[model samples]
Target: MRLRELLDATELGLLLLVGHDTDDTDDNDGIPPGTPLDRTISAVATNDLSDPGRFLTGGELVLTGLAWWQGDGDAESFVRVLHRAGVTALAAGEVEHGLVPHDLVRACRRHGLPLIAVRPETSFAAITEHVLRRLHRRDPGSLAGLAALVERHRRLLTDRAAPDSVLELLRHTLGFDVRVLSATGRQVAGARPPLRAKTAAALAARYLAARRAGESAPHHVTVGGRPYSLVPVPAPAPVRVPVPGPGPLPHPHPHPHPAELGDWLLVVEADTSLWATPDRELLDRTVELVADARAAREQANTARNDLADRSLALLHSDVPAEEIPLRLRSTAQAVVSGVGYWPRLQFVVAAGEWHAARPVPAAALRVLLEEALLQEDGPVPVSSEDIAATVDGDRAVLLVLVPGPSEAHPDPALDHAALERRLSAALARWLGPADSVSIGVSSPVPEPGNARRALEQAHNALRIAHAAPGQVTVRGPEDLTSHILSLLPLIPAEARRAFATRLLGPLRDHDARHRTDLLTTLETFLDCDASWTACAARLHLHVNSLRQRIARIEHLTQRDLSRLETRLDFLAALKSG
Candidate 1:
C-alpha cells in the first residue's frame, strides 16, 4: 500500500515542506534542510552525511528532513544516493528544519515521487499497523473455491480417468475451452472437433517427444492444424516398487501446466493472458487434485484385483467339474468384467520383468484380455490376461481366448521348425533380454464356460516354451497331448543339456566368474532362427563364433546338431525336463 493511501484512511492531514537549493534527494522526493513532517516517521536518517551510496534501502519510504545538506552540490549527491538505495518516498519535516524550500520541492516534483508533509505530532506507526492488519485477513470465498477443486479432482486421478472425462468436467467447472491430448499430442479427449489423421500424426511425435522430455512449460504446438496450448495433466508421482534387476529411477520434472491432485495434465486451450497470479496458484492446486484422483482410482482398482486374484487362486485348486465353470466365470466376471459382458477374453502371463511401470491399468488390462479373442485372422474366442490384474512378479502373464478355432492344427510338414520360425518372426518386434516373454497359445475355446480349460492349456504351452532355448518361446497343445511318443520324446534330456553345456559351458563358467554373455549367445541363437546370418544380424556376431558353438555342441553331444531331427530332439528334451 502506498503512503498516500495509508494516510488517507487515517483521516490525517499532512503539510507540504521542501528545502531550498538542497538537491540532496531525487525529484521523486527530495528532503532538504529544515522541513516539517507530521506523520509518525519510521527510521529517520540523513543521506548527505552517510556514504551517499548505500544509505537508503529500496523499500524503506525514507523519511528525511535534509538538515545535514545545504548546498546544491550536496543536494545533487544526496539525490543520487537515495535513488541508488531505492527509497520509496521521502517526507520532509518542517518544524525541525524550516519552511519548505522551493528547489528541493521542484526536484522532487520532477522525479515523480509522492512528496507528503506531516505535522510534527502525527504518528506513522499507527498507519503501518492498520495497513498490515488489512492484508492479513483472508477472503472466505476464495478459500471455499480452493477446497472444492481439491475434493473434485482427487477421484479423477485415482480412477485413471480418461482425458476426455476431465475435459468434460472442465467444460462445466472452469468454463473455458479444454483439450485433452495424448502424450503424442493427439486430441485423445477434448471439446474440440474431430481432427484429420495426418494432423494428429504430425503433432503426435512432437507431443510424445515433449512428454518424454518431461517438459513442464506449456508447449506451443499445432493441433488439428491450429495452434493449441498443451498443459500436461499432472501424473501422480510414479509409484515405485522394488523388484529384482535394475528398475527405472525417478526422474521428476517441474510441470508448468496446471494439474490438480493427480498426475493428469490440465491442458487449457485458451489465451495465455488468463494466467494471472491467482490463476497460477489455482493451476498448481488443481494438479495436486488430479494426482490425488489418479492415486485413489488406482488404489481402488488394485484392491478390487487383489480380491479377484485371490478368488482365482481358490478356483485353481482342485474343485468339482460342475462347480468349476461357475467358479471360473465368477472369477473372470468379478475381476475382468466389473461392468458388462466381456464376450472375448485373453489371458497373458508375464515370464519376465516387462511391466515395470504398471504397463497396463487394471481396467484397461482386463479389457485388453477380453478383446484378445476377437481377432478375425487366425483364432477367435481367445482370452487374453495381459492386463494389470495378472501382470505380477518377474514375468508378465496373459491368457487370450478367442471365439473360434476349436480344432486348429499345424500341418504335418509345418512341424516344430516351421512353427518356431513363424513364432520368432512374430515376436521379433519385442527386443531385449530384459523384456523376454513366452507366449503359449491355446486353441480357441467356447466362451461362457471354456476359459478354465483354455487357461490350463495356455499355461501348459507356456511351460513347454520356457523349456525351449530362447528368450521368447511359443507353443500349442499338440506337442504335449499327441498320443504317439514321437521321435522328439525319445531325445534324452542329458544329451540336450550336454550339448548346451559343451557349447556354452566355457562361456557359462566365464560368465559366473566375470558375468559374461556365453549363454547369451545361445539365447540369441535360438532367437535368431538358428541361422548363422540371422544370429549375426541379431547379435552382431561373426559367423566363426556361431559355428564354433554349433561344432562344440555336436562334438560334446556326439550328434549332428545341424540336422532338423537333432534340433527338434534337443528342443523336446529341453521341454520334457
Candidate 2:
C-alpha cells in the first residue's frame, strides 16, 4: 500500500509530521506535498526501544509511542539508528506528548527520514491493525459485521454468566481459559490452576515495562512449560479513576497516562500467534469488555475515595465546634464501617515528581499511593477504596487502617518503618524515569475527632521529607522528636556526612592516617555502653589496649569520654557516620 493511501484512511488518522508536509502545497523546496511519499509501505512495525536497530530492516514503516524518548539527544540517536536500518518512514504516537515532538521531527528530517504523526484518538494497535488489514487486502466493511457478531456472542455469555466473570464469553462458551490481571498481580478473574500472585505481578511488570519502552502488546511468555499470551486491555477513553470530590469527579486527560498501575492484562494460556484469525478478533472484542469492567471497578473506587476525601476536608474545616465530631464521623464512618472493632486510621501524605522536565499529573499520586498500598498489604484487608487516597494540589492524602493494638498484639498493628521501605519500592515500580518520592506518615488517630490533627502532623513530616536529600524519603511522627540523629531521613546525605565528619572527623582521619582501628574501637566501645572490659571482650582486645584506643579518640577529638554528655555526643556521631 502506498504511504499516501495509508495517510488518507480516516480510521488511521495519520499525518505527515515532517518529510514534506502533504498539504498539496509547493512548500517542500518547490516539490508537491504528496509527491515525495508516493513510495509503497512494505509493512508496519511498532517499537519504542531507544536502539531498535536490530529489529528493523528496509522498506518498512515503523511506529513508536516515544516512551523511550528522554531528550533531544534520544531523538537524534533513534533517528540515526532508523536511518541506518533503512526503514521507509516513522510514525510517532502522540500518547505521551499529545503531539509529535519537534525534536523527533527535526531528527527525522535531518536524517532524510519521513515522519508520520498519529492522532491522539488513535492507538498504536489501531494503526498496526489497519495497515496490516490493508496489506492483506481484507475488507474494512467486515469490521462492523464482525463487531455485531462479537456483541451477540458477548451478550449471550454475560446473560448466562455471573458478575465479576472476566472474559466469561471466552471462558464459558468458547472453552478458552483466560484470566485478567491487574498491575499488582491480583487475578481479577480466571479459571483453575490460578496464576500465582508473584508470577502475575511479574507478568504485569513485563507488560508495563514493554509498553513504557514503546513495545506493542501480545507479549508472549512461557511458564511451567506452557505458553501464554498477555494482551493489554487498552485503556478506555477518560479513565474512570478520576479526582474524587464532594461534587462530580473531574475528568482530566482523555487518555490513560495516569492509570499504569491500575491497568489490567488479559492472559490466554495459548500463544496468540497460533490462534485462528476469527478467534483473534473475538479475543480483541472480549478485551474491550474487560476494559469496561476495569472502568466500572475504578468508578466504584472513585466514589469511596470521594467520600473519604470529603470526610477529610470536613474534619479540617472551620465548622462549628459542636459539629466537628459529627461531621467527621458522618463521612468517615462508611469507609471504616467494615473494619475490626476499635478501628483506627493513620494519615499518609505523599508527593512525586518526574525526573524529566515534564509535569506528572498530580492526581496520579493518588493512584500511585493506592497501588503502593496494594503491593504492601495485598487484596484481603486493603481492597479497592479500603484505603482512601486523594490528590490535593501537588500532594496525595491517604487514610490507612492502623492495625488496632490488642493483647495478642501488644505492639502497634502496623510497622511504620517496614511499611515505608516496602511502599517506596512498590511506588518506584509503577513509575518510569521518575525515580524519587517523599512520604510522611502521622501517628494513628484513635478517634475521628483527631483526624485533622493527624493530617497536620503528616503534612509537617512531609515538609521535612521534601527538604531531605534522598531518592526516596519516608518520615513519620517519631522522626519529629528529641533524638535528632533518628531524623536523618530528613537530612541531606551531604549534610549528614558533613555532620558525622565534624563530630567524629578526628577519629576517622586518625584511623585512616595511622592505619589504626580506632573508629571500630569507638563504635564498639559506645555499643558496649562505655564498659571498658565489655568493649575489650567484644573486640578481643585487652582492657589496656581498649583504653589506649579510647584515650586516643578522646585526645584526637579533644573531648572527655569520662563525661556522660561527651560519651553520648560521640555515640551519636559514630551512629551518624
Candidate 3:
C-alpha cells in the first residue's frame, strides 16, 4: 500500500504529519507531499531500542514507542539508523508520551523519512494487521496473470515447454530481460539478446567473490554501464540422514558432497532501485521456477552421463570388438540426437592442477567441456550434441562428433586449429589463475569399432600434452613420431629412472669430477647429425676440442658413435633421462 493511502485513512488522517509544524519552509520535516508514495510495505515491526536498524529490512514500516528517547540528540541517531537500514517510513506511538516530540519530527525531516503519528486510541496492532492483510491479497486483475504463470511453470516442469520459453513468458509478463547463468559464467537458459561470454564470466566472478565474503544475496552490480541484480538460486536442501537404531551397523553409503563453489545465479538486467514489492515477489517466484527447470535438466542428463561413462569404460575394458559398435551406437544415440551412426568420433582428455583441499577440478572441467561444445557465439559454432564425462580424479573424457558433408555446407572437415583455439580461450575465461588445464585431442576414428584404440591414443596423447611445453596438444596422424616417445609416460617411474641412470650415470660422474662437458658435447654432436664442424660451431668450440670431448665420451660410455644403432641407443637414453 502507498504512504498516501495510509495517511488518508479515516483513523490515521489527523495523525499523519508530512512536515514540521514550524513555519520554516526550507525545513520540511518529513517526506515531500507531492513525492511518489507508491512504495509497498513489506512488514511492520515494533522496536523500543535506541538502535533498531539491525532488526529492519528495506521496505519495512517500523513502529516505535520512543521509550529510549532521552533528548533531541537521541532522535537524530534513531532516525538516521532507520534511514540507513532502508526503513520505508516510521510510525511513532504516543502511548508512553502525550504527543509526538518536535525533536523526532525535525530528525525525520532531515533524513527525509515519512512519519505517521500513532493516535492515542488507534492501536499499532490494527495498523500491522491491515498491512499484512493487504500484502496477502492479490489484485483481482493479477489473479489471471498468476494462473497463467503457474500453468507455464507446470509445463516447464513436465517438459512440455523449454526453459527458454519460461524466460520468454516472464519477459512478456514483466517486461524485463533475464538470464540464468552457471557459476563459471556459462549461460544455462534465458531470453536473448545473450550476454557475451567474457561479460558473463566477469559477473560470475563478482558473484562468487561476494558469496565467499558471506554477503547476502540480491547483489547489485553495474556492467557495461547498465545495472543488474544477481540473485543466487540456492541449491536444494540436503536429505536428512536417519538416526541409527539399536541394530547392527549399516554399510555407509558415499554421497558426493554438494559443490560449494559453483552455484546458479538469476541475473536481472534492471536497476534494483526501481523494483517494487510486486516486482521483487515476481522475481523470487521466477527464481524458483528456474531452479526447478535446472534440476529437471540435470536429472535428464544423468542418464546420458551414465551412458557416456559406461561407453568409455567398455572401450577401456576387454570388451568384444564385434559388440563394441553396438553398445557405442546406443550410447551415442542417447547423447547426440538424430544420429543413427557416429561415423567419426574424436576423443578429448583433459586434466588440471588440483589440490586435495579444493573442490575437484575435474568437476569444473566437465562443465567447461560442456560449455565449449555448446558454445554458439564463435565463428564456427560448436555443436551441442557432445558428451563429457568425468572418468577419474582430476581427469575427464569428452566425445565430440565430427560433422560430415551436408547439403547446405558440403565441406565438413573440422578446423582443428580453430577448435583448439576456442577451447583454450574458454579454459582461460573460466578457470581461476591458481589452476591450470591441459587438454589432448585425438585424431578422429572411423567408427565405434575403433573406439578402444582411439581411447588409448587419446590417453597417450594426453600424456604427451602434459609432457609438452604448451597447455594444449592435439595428436593427429602426423604426431606418430612423438607417439613412440609418449609411451615412456606409461612406464613405471622407478624403471624409467633406473634406465636413465644406468645409461648416463658414468658420463655424469666423470663430468662432475673433471669439470668436463662430455654429455653436452655428445648430445650436441648427435643433434647436429654427427657433423664435427657444425657441433663445434654450435658449442662455440674448435673442431679439435669437440673431437677430443667426443673421444672422451666414447671412451667413458664404451660406444662407437659411427654405428647407427649406437646413435639410436644414445638418443633413447637421452630421452629417458
Candidate 4:
C-alpha cells in the first residue's frame, strides 16, 4: 500500500505525525501519489539496531520502537541503513521513548523517506496485522475485478460488438495472449502479430481432431513447446426451454455432438490445469462471448454470400454488358476493396468424389479454397479477395480478380499456377489419395461481361481435369488437345457413336469376320507415327506385310493415311469409339 493510504486508513488514523515533503517538487521519495497500492509487503521487520539492512529485501514498511536511539548519529545511521536497504517507508513507535525524536525525523527528511509516528497505544504487531490483511485482500479483489471485466465483454458482445473488438478487449483487460480459430483451423480472429499460417492450421487441425474424438474442451495441448488450452465454442442452442408449460416439452441440445461440424475453438495461451476456479470461470465466459461473436459474423457472411451468388447469377444470365457492371458493383466492391473496375477475372471450379446419391462436399472445398488464399507463401496471396460460390451441389466456383500491370508481380498465370499447386496439396490432405478432387482454373477474362465465357471455360477445364491422370488439371487456351477432348463430352452419345461407326465400322466388321489383325495394325501404325518399319516391328510382321495391311485399311475406310487431315480424322474416330 502507498504510505498515504496507510496514514489515512481508519486503523492507523489515530497515529499522527506523518512526514511529508516540504518542497513543492512532485517527487514523494521517488514514488508519485497516484502509484498503485498493490505492492505487497514482503515481510514486516522490527529492529532497534543501528544496522538492520541485512534483514530487509526491499518493499518492507519497516517498524522501529526507538529503543536503540542514543543521539542524532545513531538516528542518522539507522535511517541511512533502512534507506539503503530499499525500505518503502519507516514507522517509528513512540511507546518507550514517549515521543518520536526530531533527529530521526530530520534524518528521514534528509534521506527522502516517508516516516510515520506510531501512537503510544498502537502495538507493532497491530500495524503488521493491518498490512497483511490488506495485502491478502487484494487477491479476492482482483478476482472480482476480472469477473467484472469479463461481464463487460459479454455485454459488449450482446450489444453486437465485433468479434475482434471483443478479443482485443479480453487481451487488454486480462493480459492474456489468445486466438480464435474456425473448425477448418483457419484463423477467424485474434491473431495479433499473426501466427504463422502453418502453425494456425496445425492448431486448428488438432482442435478439430480432439472434437472428433469426443474429447472435452478447455483441454491442454502444446504448440511450439508452449502449452495452450483448446476450448470448443459450440453453436448456439437452437431451442429455448419453456416456462413450465403443460404440452410436450422441447428438448434443447445444449452441447454439440461430435458429428456436427463448424464449431469454433478458443486457443488460450496458458494451461487451464494450472488456473484457479475464477480464472477457469472467466475462460468459460470468454468462450461464450466468442461464440456469440462468431454467430453474428456468420450471419453477416451469409448475407455477403447471398449477394455474391446473385451477382454471379446475373453475370451468367442474359444481362447486357453495360448493365452487368452496374449489377456487380456492390458485390465486386465488397469482395475486393478499392477496385473501380475488375479489369481481369479468372474462374476456378472445384469438385470431389462422393456416392451417386450423396452430394459432394462443395462447402468444404470452398472453405479450403478460402484458407489457401490466406497463406502468405501461396501463389495468389490475394485470393482472400476472391469471391467463391457453391454454384452447385457438386462444384464450387471462384471469381478471382486478376492483378493489373501496375500492381506488384502482375503475372496472373504464375499466381494462378502457384495457387493451383497449394490448393491441390491441401485438398490431397483433406481428401486422401484414394479419393480425389479436381480443380480447373480458366485463363483471365477481360471483364465481368465475359463471366459466362469464363465459367464455361472453367467448366470445360474441369471436365478435362476429371479425365486427366492427376487430381488437378489446368486447361488454358494453349492446351488445344485437352480443349478439343473436353468439347467432345458436350456431344450427344448417339451422335458420337454415329460418327465413330461411320469411320471405323468396316474395319471392325472385317476384323470380326475374317479374324484378321487389320484394326490392331491400323492402331499400331497410327501410334508409330505412320512408320512402316516401326509398325512392322511392333506387330512382328515384315515391312511388306505392314504395307499391305495399311493399303487394305485405307481402301476399306476410303481415307488416305498419308494426309494430315485424314490422320487426325482417324485418330478422332478411334478416340470417339
Candidate topping lDDT: 2
Q: Which regions of candidate 4 deviate over 4 angstroms? A: 1-142, 154-165, 168-176, 182-188, 233-264, 299-303, 315-343, 353-360, 375-391, 407-437, 464-577
What is the lDDT of every predicted structure here?
Answer: 0.45, 0.64, 0.63, 0.62
Q: Which residue pairs clash within candidate 3?
A: 29-109
Error of 4 at 96 (Å): 51
- Candidate numbers, best lDDT first, in rank order: 2, 3, 4, 1
TM-score of each: 0.36, 0.50, 0.49, 0.50
Q: Write the per-residue lDDT of candidate 3 for residues 454-518, one digit (tens) a residue.
A: 56656666666656655444444234335556777898878877877887888999989999888
Q: Candidate 2: where is the Cα deviation over 4 Å?
A: 1-164, 172-177, 221-227, 234-258, 320-323, 334-343, 357-359, 375-380, 411-434, 461-475, 479-483, 487-577
TM-score of 2: 0.50
| Collision pairs in model 2 | none
Please report the candidate that would top TM-score against the real structure: 4
Cα lDDT for residue 104, model 1? 53
Winner on TM-score (1 vs 2): 2
